[model samples]
Target chain A: MSPDLLLCLLAGLLVGCGVHLLLARSVVRALLGFLLLGNGINLLFVVAAGPRGRPPIVGLGEESQPMADPLPQAMSLTAIVITLAMTGFVLALAHRSWQLSRSDVVEDDPEDARIGLRAIENDMSESDFHGGVDADPRHVDPDEAPPGTVPEEDDGSDPDPDAAPVGSAPGEGAEPGVPGSDDAEAGLDADRPDHVDPDPSTPEPPARRPGQEGAL
Target chain B: MSGEMLHTVLTALVPLPVLLPLVGAGIALVVRTRTRLQRAVSVTTMSLVLVIAITLLWGADTQGRLLVTVGGWLPPQGITLVVDRLAALMVLVAVTVTFAVLLYAIGQGRGAMDRESGGNAPVPIFHPTLLVLLSGVSTTFISGDLFHLYVGFEMLLAASFVLLTLGATIDRVRAGISYVFVSLASSSVFLMALAMIYAATGTVNMAQLSVRLAELEPATALVLQVLLLTGFAVKAAVFPMSGWLPDAYPTAPAPVTAVFAGLLTKVGVYAILRTQTLLFPASPLPDLLLWASLLTMLVGILGAVAQDDIKRLLSFTLVSHIGYMLFGVALASPAGLSASIYYVAHHITIQTTLFLVAGLIERRGGSTSMSRLGGMAAMSPGLAVLFLVPALNLGGIPPFSGFLGKVGLLQAGAEQPTPLVVALLVGSVLTSLLTLYAISRVWSRVFWRPPSVAPMTEDNRLERRYERRFALAPGVVAPTAALVLVGVALTVAAGPLLAVTDRAAAELLRPDGYVALVFGGGEVP
Candidate 1:
């Protein structure tokens, strides 16, 4: 029942190196780590199959000698195949990442990034009721704004409010010519005015109001 | 059929659930160019599997655990597929959900396929991969050997990697990378554990391990238990290991997200349940599991509260609810186990229904972001209703399966009323309240409020264009509604279902029946 020291050492080394590589940010490196880890486990499987013996072929070895357990070898073969398939899939994914963003370093989720920014700015308690009204005004378009409401630069302290709509113009202008864009935009435009009609009960707060930490 | 005849027939039917989908996947891949043929093959295969799963459930319930040895090989040596009530129930629920999701995906039509391929030549990868995933899931449920279970894990993981990153969009690719790495790491841990188990016991079969594992030194048994639990914990997205889920799942296309959200982690929970009950019946690590479950609940719900996107929010809640199952498992009582099994079945249907509804919301409003979505209640009352039932079901509202499952778990905890159990009870109740808050937040923002001007993000722009092309089809909505009804059905059928789960839990606690059945001579009667 004593496992081979050399084989155990090899498995340990492989697993150690594999884990180190897996923690890397690069997808390709992680793939390498996976392959190493797979091999390490495969080696561990070999060791776990018990002390080395004659090839597991029946009647090929002397009857008195013990045969190597064939089951771990079979299981490891399956593991090797799975590892190979996964490697191909990960490589394809890494390639796609490179194609899409010209980098293979896993990018942070945008929503997570936005949340992190909000945390850093100490603005985490913004109520869901504002309904994107308090979102960066840059997301809103000027022409879509109601006629009288369009010129509200009176607060003036935060430049982002008045400048947002002006900045949104070119983006909206470029989008209109695209097929199907109009129908989509029109549907939203119809909804936009209703959203903009300020709630008398909960008056629209000044754009970019300071974080109300306990708002929730 | 006579009782003995029925037993034989049922035992024979055991392998079909795994075999049929695989065969169907192969055929679907061959006929990939013909989308219609592929769809028919996929659906027909799953429908058959669904039928077989139902029969197996009946057989397992009446005739007791139906056992099949692959290639007619005997126990402790051959790969065994056992249909105990638990496995049969899992396979049945999983197949049902996957079948519905398949129909939903098909209803979505070419636009859905196009979204996956990013408008490239239609790859037809979806049907084949989904079938393979189904087969993998069945394999895990029925597998009676640890190595076979690992193979099943790899099969589903491989297929899921393809589904999750189907379009190769930057966001999906980013998410897929992390997902693939985490999954691979866990699989490695599982494989390592298998190695140690085999080395310690000289066999991988569950029946034999149930006997041999107890004879090992306490330290050796504890090491093996910790290793196996660690691997499953990662797969289950237990608190510390859960960071990858919200990031990865939200980026997939909606049906893909729905199925993954519903079934994948539950599969991990199933494995943990099976092992803890059968192989390590007197688990040395229930305290560890109890703590893990508590944190998984609290941390996951808090994370859900912070998410603005509907899919991401659901993803966090998915992680949170896995704790409930673990909570039941940790209690190590028949009632606890029964409640966990019921909760797993309930959560699978409810979670999938909600995600499908989220998909509907995305289509109707052109975004899943709570900020960008609003007025869905006014715009589409039917869609609002579709979203509401499942939302309340998930929030543990009275008369829903969610509430039933939680009440069962809490009642089980109260049986002991130890200090730790008391804390878990409080934590779980708190978690349920927070879940309601988060779900209600989604309901009001996405359905009730006035529509906001969504930012012109490139992703949603493309989404809107596709949404315009395929205006909310009945095909998509019907399957989602059907799944919603399925969740409601679980609530309605609670009496019989709980009876089945209680019987399953009783069998799980006593491994003698399983071990004897597996090793007892070939004649099932």
Candidate 2:
């Protein structure tokens, strides 16, 4: 059966507008988007029920005139209730967000943001960094390499000798000269050089560094 | 009892799993002010449901599928709840996990309440909401109609939104917004898919659709399949759609995160499994599933490897292992499907146990960050053991059920021996190895290394005070240890469990039994 073109077009319009709003960063907009999206789908349900007919009452409609399918209407009613409940819930969440952070925008996950920043600094893919793929062989110490196998470009002529030493010492500290040291320092104990010395007898501190937790 | 009476009795038991928790949820909500009574009511309700699920499992195993028409209305016109082997097994495992997590949440809640001395009495909403979530999950498992399944998803999603933001802490609020939006988006997609399906087939009943969907043109069927899979994949946290999971899950209280991590996504996987097997048996998208599985595995594990927080790490692994189940489903063979089913059950228990263990780690170590946590093994050897067993199980160590499930999937892949299957087999092993690496990294950093000296700061001081207030409770530890034992139990029972899953897979791959039973007047054949 051919679907109702006008209803279909209306549903399409609502869905298109709904998705556009859903992509916005603001929670209120997303909630509105959800409402519109839900209503669009509900309309689709109506359209799917086929050609319109008299109210699906048992005795009100004549036998010659077919009644609308009641099933989709029932289903759409359920959908409306659920959508209303969720809209209320999301509204509450948006209010909570405003109360907590004084903003209604969805915040980027701190860890994700940090990782993205590191990826840019390192000029590498985020997955490569996460996968522990070291792009530059120079980050590997020349001393650790076999005697004859050092790259031809590596003549130990680099201006920064300390860079070599930092790269050579395992777990001493992240290389400050490296572009992604911000990530390394935040991730490892590189920022707190005192942590480099493993003092077994030191009492456990009551507090960790503020803001270092990064969304834990 | 005579055969007829037995059938009647078993049919009567089918609805209890969904009904009991809902009724309990109502009672718990009424008694919300009395924390003790709420706990008791919730626990009792779940226990009773657990018993009913076990009986249903036995009945379904012995007597073909058990069907129940809601309100005594016949199918294609009424809501149907069918407990074939697949649904029964899923319900049983789901109830078991929810029950244990509830115990852990209760223990944790009690500890928090005691320390605060009623100043921060546990939010009474947790009990009722959790019960509602359990009911929603059970409804999804037993639902015989597509729209009913959609309702089940909404019930659970609404309940979860409440549970996730229980305390409405800033971090949780932030997390909950993203979670709610993503869930709503997926639910809309699912609703749209249902609308389309109804438009095509003129019915929402699965049994009727099973017969009717087969007659539709191939292209139409593929569109429906893709739409359905898209919705379920987001819920399941399959790749490209999985980014929200790690971000959203880690910020909640441990028990909330534990249940969400364990059961919520599995519900999505269960829907995918149900639809794939019963509605679209001749899936045109196995290749798509295979590619998705491979990407999910690789991408999810890589994310896990980079994570410093144990909760986020476990969340990523949860997404990664979903690939293994998808792999089994993609194979579309009995061995493959059976192995996938076994893996789902195995992964649910293992993943939940690990999250519970992470909670324990947080309680004892004062943080779940691998950087901040250390020497937990030395400080709390019992907690260490609890963490180690599940960690090993999750990493697919030999003799664990994880290994067994992977072996089954691999062997199934071997049977197909197609290039894509071969690629998946290799990818599966790689994912497993990478998983082990990620897990071991967490183990060494969080458990073995010397405790780091955290810098003294006001935030840290407040956190320490909070930690001291809710000092580790034996009540909490016991439930976690119990769940860890449950994971081991999966290992010990792997043999018989595989047998059940094998039969379940056979039934899933062959949908005629289901269609027949659902339409055949709820009768035992």
Candidate 3:
């Protein structure tokens, strides 16, 4: 077979494998799929460059041979750089995923899952029930409070039980909703005791459940 | 300046908008350790770029498409940059949005220590990468060659990947994965189609292709068009291919998400507008665009209705509204093109403003969920005003630019009188009503009702434990409020903006003008 036909077969096999791997649940596997796909495109660019020839570059005391089409080579190089950067980025992401969820497999997005459930149930209020304490690992730490927010008093627990997708910020849920609440703290502190933290014991500690992909 | 003088000057300045930000990105990266310096560099570069965009818009309107062939080489050989009215207007709005979002990010990043680090979140990457993204966008807007456009897309896509996963949390990483994979897939498809186009035409200059593409077999042209549109549809998030957007967007930092929602899709729309008009004016797929847009509008609005969270709801609406722009594209008349341009300008500002307001709601009201957020109108009247103005505008309330844009598009649709056009008109009206219904539901549940009751209390500040970060700063609210006012100002200045769009539409409908300016004698209007 001609080189073009052979290269086309190679690219096809690569794309096929890449697409198949893309459907896998594992994060690392998906990254591999991305690499394969990127490589296939680069190869196709080369194939599109037509019949190969000598290097396009010129050298001292020698006439340039019938030069290869250099534009596709340039295109291929750029694509490779993009693929490399993406690979590095994806690797970092996989590491982060491993640290957070302690699993390599990509988990279903919590928000997506919530929306799916809402669609199935056809009940908005029922979906709102899932708005309990957002399991975001970031807000569980006590030290995360914005400066001057009274660190000890600030709680990251859910203030509104019925709010779907409750924010994972500290001292949320039961907003005082008083005009100038934060600004008027100096004057309003005496009478603002009504909305103070119901449990001074503190918000729940960071839950580090492992092996389960959704657990964070 | 005289028209000739303006024309000559704009020719010189055509490449600066793309170049300055790139230089700034490099400089900012070099001095990344100095956070304040990096901020200054990014902001200053983008501000200058905004000025250039405005100047180019003035030049394009008074003169014509300003063409610059790089390094003294001419078109069909060297790369060309065409700063037409559509491009100039796009970059001007886009850069302004970028600058405002930068200000918002700067304000939000101040003084507040990261929750995890006990030190500040790394400022080095965000500012520099944002400048890189700006450069990429400017390149895309100004690029005249197809390969150059592809490079621009890659540049932005690379920068956005960094932006999307800035914090490196489980949520962000997950979203980033989907975003990256889909973007890669789209780029791959785009590359393949680009190769095919080059193979068929022997040149990738859009002007040259416009002349050459007409000679190709219709079947070949249709295949190429399908490949290109599929790639662009994924980028623009037109239904079906849009599944990755809402899932990937809401996880990023507010400013990043806002810019992504506002400017990125518009670039895709701009691509569709240009390629469809210039290369394939006698298209084989006008009906495909028409049907696709109708489905896009309906599906997006329906998704918005089902969404409980503000960010996701906005994302869905963003998808829905692209159909309105597509309607303009589908109609393919001067009126349709103008309406699309006007609608695009209206959408960019309003959508970005909405996301910024959502950030504020999350900050002050404790959550962006409608069910959790209530009585906010009483608590913070500032946030209430910020949210309502744009929310009303988004719902196509009267006198706002949104309403004006819709009316312009509807009138354009009415001109065709074809059965397909008639169905699209009805679909647009229905979509607008559904949009109103969805947004009003958010209004009632979020701003009007009494605050939800719960046992525990927490301050609504940026509180992720992964890093030290900027949460609620005094400066954050001001820029966002200013953006809302810009939304209102778009309404106030609707007269002139519409004239400009009408002219842009005229230019788009008459591709000969663009091709002439780029290749035929290069005369000023």
Candidate 4:
């Protein structure tokens, strides 16, 4: 095969294989794919520089064939350096993931799942926006005081959704002072990040919240 | 300096804004152990950059387009750095915001040290990395060639990957992975496009391409245009391409998020604006831009409203608001371009201010979740005011620069008045209203409600809830308030700023003067 044809075939195979790996779930494979793609691009850039000729250096009046362009060589070097830097960072990240989770697979994101569910749940017709409350039976009380109103010093058995220190009525799921500014604006607070205390019934150290898994 | 010498020096000073921060970063890296000296170097470097940026703006406005060829090679043979009105204005805003964020980060760093890790807690490498990021952004702004712009993107992306993973929390590491993959993918596309442009036209010197590209067949030109635009589209986070942004931006520390939110996407817009005007003057896909602007605005705002997190909400709005800039770019008129330019500046200040305010909220309330935070208005009135001002500005309330930019764009859209343009106009108005709705929602939820009232679902979580007035230090509050003042100043000075934007747009639309300056008054042979 001609030099250009061979180069083209090699570049195509690298790119095809790279894209396949890039789509895989495993971090190590994805990283390999990224490297393959970079090499493929470098090859594409070299081939695009057109038919190779004599080394581009010129001496005084020396007879020479057409000199090959050197810009792609420079670009390929730069691209290789960038790829090397990125590869180091990715390897660090992969190593970190393995250390933390004992696997090199990317974790499934709950946030992404929630967002996809939100798109389907939100057609924008409902007056309220939050897709209803969590399926857990314990959180269904409308009469309970809203979260965050009770000072940290106080246990939240009184459940003040409207801790009306000012003019708020004491009970019966207090009315909002500002009409437009209500819990309703945010739609339903369903799936709101709940504060699951050590259950009074079980009395254990508080269970780590799912999202607060990371140490601050 | 003598007048002649001054002109020469000023001609040379065009590259200093890009150089100063790099030098500062290098020096800071060396003295990284000496916290005070590190701060001094970074601060002095950015201050000098700010001064240089102002001088460059004055010089560009008066001196026509100033061009520098690295190592004195002519035209397409060397890397060209040009300081036009647009480049100078962008540099000024970028440095100013970076400086403000630096102040906030330093103060925050000190305060975090005092609070948690006492006595000379290892001064973070934040300053050097931030300066490096600033240098990359400066390079992106002033670069006169497509290849230099790619280098700028890489430098910044590498810096950001480090910044985003500052703490290496599992969440941040996750965000970093997504950020890296998305950025690298776009960068590869950008490189492919650059290679193709070189292959097709034999040049990536944008000014030279301006002359060469016009001669290509329409179909061939269209393919090249699409490729280049796709690369910029990813950077600009236009609509479907913007998914990585909301994911990536919110995971970083507040100041990091603020700087990234402010500078990165706008630089992408700047790239799109510059390349579209220069290389492909009569773009083949204004209709595509129109549809894109429409969808990006609608979808981004909808996504913003659906979220409960403050940083994520602002991130969504940032993506949504880029549509307004694209709207102007799509119209392809002087009025449209000017409006886009003005909006870009306005959005940078507004977005940065809002994100910084989000930082303050997180610091004060211990959470950015609207469901968790409340009573900020009464407890920390200062923080409330800080959030309110930029939030209102972002929502496009009257007398704000946001409102002015929207009106300028709407009027420009009216001038040509195509069906698609009209659709975009309606979308713009709707987006603004929805932005207001979204901002007001945050205000009522986080600021209006007493800290006592929390989300219905969060039961018996008093220990985690912040109980008292947040006693903030003078340092964090001052820089944040300073950025807020910057946003207000934009509104106050809209008249003169709009004039400058108009001049920049005029220069952009008519780039023969620029091309000549870059190419030494010669046509591309």
Candidate 5:
């Protein structure tokens, strides 16, 4: 029946609506819902605390009725300011996310999660885990290759625990070319770098692997 | 010469602890552009608070109890802040921990702060919000009225929302939302309980409640106790009500997590301790608290065991250790109260040190998961050593303060000589063993294993951007070293600290000392 109570109920309903929206998985909508919810709560404080009193002026005598509790009003003002600041910050973040991934919906970091799961599963599949056969494009067979011949991709796999990568590796796993052999060989033959084509005379592998899908 | 003058002055100091930060927060908000100025303000505000806490502690010890009625209103007429032995002790512990964490935050740089606030640079708002939260915490501990306590909780929670999700990322926001929503709900429950108590009794003053409790029927009192306890249990992260804690705490930035780890939940514990003794005295609630503490301990340590993430594991550990404080309080004896207070203090430093070191672990190792991180020892031996001290302290190894606190609690438990004691003692040992195991796992994965990945020569770009903005770095060696030294210092200085706690506890168990101080008149009983 009271106006303040009615306002409080309306604010409460808005808060409920906000909560419903927040529960949705869409990030932008959720952000909007949070904004609405915070506003609703701020409104409720105003209603619940009743209208602000003749502002608590020290030493002022002539005030009409029992002034409203200034505490809740002050609290509401503080809350509104904080919520606004938070909203602005959140919008910026949302905008950045949109720029980075082109959506406001939260995407699953499947790669990171899958990597985690893979690490856990490594113990169960040690035989397969170490095989590196998954796709070691630069892996040269140690038994067949000459000694001290470097693998093109270090791929950060430890050959020896103590050996630090001496600028020969850039991408955790990529090994730089052997130091002296390349430029000398490059200067001798303008057409070839020694690291890339050790034996140019050796015929290139067939363009298509035998029995591969859609092979020519 | 005059008792009234002393009471008035002591009461005035109560709001200062909280007001200073709030004023500082307002100033920080205005001067948001100047980062250095904000830092200066924040450091100065917190230092003032630290000094206030020390002075208040000395005053409370000397003057008995101090009461500050806001706006010069009398008790039950307006909000009253009361400083008693228990509350003063809490303030001391919180100040000490906050001081250490702030220093560590500064040393660690903007990177750490940025990580804490998500990706935002360390803004002036952080210092303001953090100070505001600390003031809330200090007031919550010392508040004489239940509603004032609720206000304190809200202050801390609102500030924490900003602290937890400073950068406002999706995950941090989600976590912050949960943290705030759950806390707000608990606060609502607390308010309802307060209303019910006021309806039942004519007053909300804690000391007055104690005297008035006996006149009320047992059932109504029990209902009030349970309702109030449940609300605080949510805050304390007690076993059944603690589901939200694990999900939210680990997701925050490290310094926030460290302080949250160190102090926030303990406020809930302090409330429970205050209520059980004052409002629901001689009830079955002690047994309930005992069971709750026991279950919380077992459940928390077990939860820690299941988590692979370092932060998550530590969060569980934080939950589990709360049981020790609850157990001490549940005993409802002088010795039990003192033991709980001492344990609460010791645990604050230890838990914070552990979490900060966890930050250092994340910094050096690049990930928090044990399996992915290896051989940090070779890269940062200082960090490795830093991790060792807190880890060992948490494990309750001897020659450390953690062991002393546990021993004190165990002694308190034994004094009761009941089945509850046996249960608590067993839980204590088992939890300690599990915690030790968890620490060892961190060490072996982080320190002992061969370097699996080459050290990162350049900082991660994302990490750098965060640092450039916030200056949040895990300046591990200094803050970690300082906290470690504090832990060791606690170990060495246990004699005097425990002595003070014992005296404080004795005063708390005898309510006359507090009541006389608060009402500013003769003994009530």
Candidate 6:
């Protein structure tokens, strides 16, 4: 049971554990784990190069025998610098993520999730259309927007007899005329009205008939 | 002159490709004003490097082999630079294409493209990073040892990560993160492979490894070979391990994608060629390599067939063409290796051209999706003509470089007198036709039809005039000129290039030539 052998085993164990933890959910824990892993490798490098020697920096012209290998120590120093920089960057990223989303659990980006869902729905509809089975839940009528607000042009062209009341974000099958055209504010606001929220709100339709909802 | 002095001078050359761009990049980075000056300096530096690389190639060809050991130490103790024919040729081609692309980037005018694309201006760091990347590729091709190869790979990877995520758009970010992760993972595997080879043979020097590897027990040697291949396969984007490339290549900024599509995977192919020829010639891996390449060819083309997006389809084609290069290497014959080398040079130019032109498509037609794009030919006849030439060449149309390269490979396969060779030949031909079909489909849909949706928006900023006489030059003209010229050169100079490739093939097949140069005493026989 040589001490050097035990040291190597411990370092290897630390690296394995550190890597495992680094892959976990908690950012702070991952950073700590990375530090431990780096230290573990540095220790392993020193031991593997050999043990029981004086430190490498020479003092005066003193007689030297079995000086410790300087290369591994140098490598460790570089590794430490790199690790420090990486850790700082990772911390910044974590902070930014928290500020943006208030959590660091690494959730799916909303827009990207929309795209992925679109792709999946496309696939589902494609298969259902081909298989001649029940219709896919994602099958939007060609004339309508895909479960979102319809464009203004669509609203103008396809007038809805039972449309929602005026003074709202343009919805599917709205009236043909400009809303509040007779009001003096129409000329005042050539662009979007000042009062309107940039992000349009879609009033959630009260629970629909299950059969109609599922028909998509 | 003393040998040490000459060696020092030569070693100085080893760092030239790497340092010059960094020097230029530093200038570009700090100099905030006078964008024109920055462009001039970057272009001048790159042009100088291209010239130097060409001269070096000439010297290498005439002088047998060029070895430059850094810091004056020799053998297993110091980093070495060995410029054999293959390395010299790689540096020459890489320098040529990189310089051309840089010119195109400058000529195309980032201001215009950014305005047209309705985006924030592109960072000037793009050119600097690209130049830095070329430096890495040049060194990777010339480095004499595995460790240096690993460093070169890292240098390239880091630059490529920056390139891939250039705009940091959401899509680009997602793609870039996956790309960086997969690449770094492969690199870690490469590092482990290096360690294993060093441990097994007690040497990492390519020259020394070449001689000592023969002495290793078959099993240990086999393990090292397989590990090395796996590491390279990830980089080479070989089938089954190549999932990352299709996602990554298309999402990058155009010029960046062009160079990456052009040179990066070829570096991996170069590594595989070098290692298999030098370190593991008798390892019984050639048969397996042939089969893998055959599958790569088939699977890659099929993947291309299934893709609707222009970039993804081209990416699949890029993956598939790698099989032909591997085919040449797997044959273990001079013709095969030489053809592969030639094909690599051709493929780099062709693939870069393809991706560059694809960028033009995105620029002129708006979206890269075939469904969204059409009537490019009617709008920009020059761009249409430019795209047609490369597209046909990519499909292995006669007299084009692709045809010549494929013919050379098929000839080598024919000489093998084995069923595997037959399959390789048939597979090569079939893939060529399938690829042609895909290219034609893209051509008809994108170039030959009326605009599918709305006409491309007018953005004068993106267009660059090539000449006063032709002042109405298409927006794609400057961006695609370099690639188009490369395609033309490949077609016109096919004879001379193939001859050079033949010589290279001969050198690779006969281990004696390479080993003798590396060992450097006299003839082994």
Candidate achieving the largest lDDT: 1
> Distance from true position, residue A100, model 5, in Å?
9.6
TM-score of each: 0.88, 0.86, 0.84, 0.85, 0.73, 0.76
- By summed lDDT, the worst window of 10 consecutive residues in model 4 chain A runs over A160-169
**lDDT by residue for model 4 (B1-525), tens:** 676776798888988987888888899988876666777898899889999999988888877778889878666857899989999999999998999999887756533321111111223567888998999999999999888889999999888888887755456667777787778888887887887677777777888888888888888888888888898899899988998899889878789899999999998899989988888887647999999899999999998988778999999999999999999998888999999999999899889989988987876665687755666676567778899999889899988889999999999999998888888889999999999999998997788855543334344333232222223546667788899999889989988888888999999998677787776676565
**Top-DockQ candidate index:** 1
Looking at model 6 chain B, report the run of 10 residues with the lowest lDDT sum: B461-470
DockQ of each: 0.14, 0.11, 0.12, 0.10, 0.03, 0.04
Mark the regions of model 2 whose C-alpha exceeds 4 Å error after superposition: A119-216, B110-122, B454-471, B521-525
lDDT of prediction 1:
0.82
Model 4: fnat (fraction of native contacts): 0.08
Regions more than 4 Å wrong, model 6 = A1-216, B1-14, B112-122, B454-476, B510-525
Q: Distance from true position, residue B159, model 5, in Å?
A: 0.5
Candidate 1, residues B1-525, lDDT tens digits: the string is 788988889999999988999999999999887766777898899989999999999989998998899998887888899999999999999999999998888766544443333234233788888899999999999999999999999999999998888756556788899999999999999999999998999899999998899999989999999999999999999989999899999988888899999889999999999999999996647788899999999999999998888999999999999999999999989999999999999999999999998887765554687766565676677888898998899899999999999999999999989898899999999999999999998887777655445555654554443332123566677899899999999999999999999999999998978888898844321
> What ordering of candidates by lDDT runs from best to worst?
1, 2, 4, 3, 5, 6
Each model's lDDT: 0.82, 0.79, 0.75, 0.76, 0.67, 0.67
Top candidate when judged by TM-score against the true structure: 1
Off by over 4 Å in 4: A1-3, A60-62, A115-216, B1-3, B110-123, B455-470
**Winner by TM-score between candidate 5 and candidate 3:** 3
Docking class of 2: incorrect
Residues B1-525 of candidate 3: C-alpha lDDT, one tens digit per residue: 676876789899899988999999899888876666777788789888888888889988888789999987788777899888899999899888888888877765522211221122353578878888988998998999988898899899989988888756456777988888888888878987887786676677888888788889999998888899999889999988988889988877778889999988888888999888888998837788989899999999989888878999999999999999998998898888998998998899889989988876766654566644555665556667888889889889898888999999999999988888789899999989988888887876677655443222354232221112113445567778788888888899988998998998888777777678778656322
Model 1 residue A97 lDDT score: 69
lDDT for each residue of candidate 5 in B179-261, tens digit (9 for 90 to 100): 65567556645755665565566566787787777678988888888989988999999988887787787777677789898
Listed per model, the TM-scores of chain A against the true chain A are 0.62, 0.55, 0.55, 0.55, 0.52, 0.50
- Docking level of model 3: incorrect
lDDT of 2 by residue, A1-216 (tens): 789898899999999989999989999888888888988999999989998788888889687898889999999999999998888888878876665456788878876787667656874442323423122223332212211122222212233211222112221122223222223223233323333432333223222222211101
Question: Considering TM-score, which of the candidate structures 3 and 6 is the better prediction for this target?
Answer: 3
Angstrom error of the Cα, residue B337, model 2: value is 0.6
Worst 10 residues of 2 chain B by lDDT: B112-121
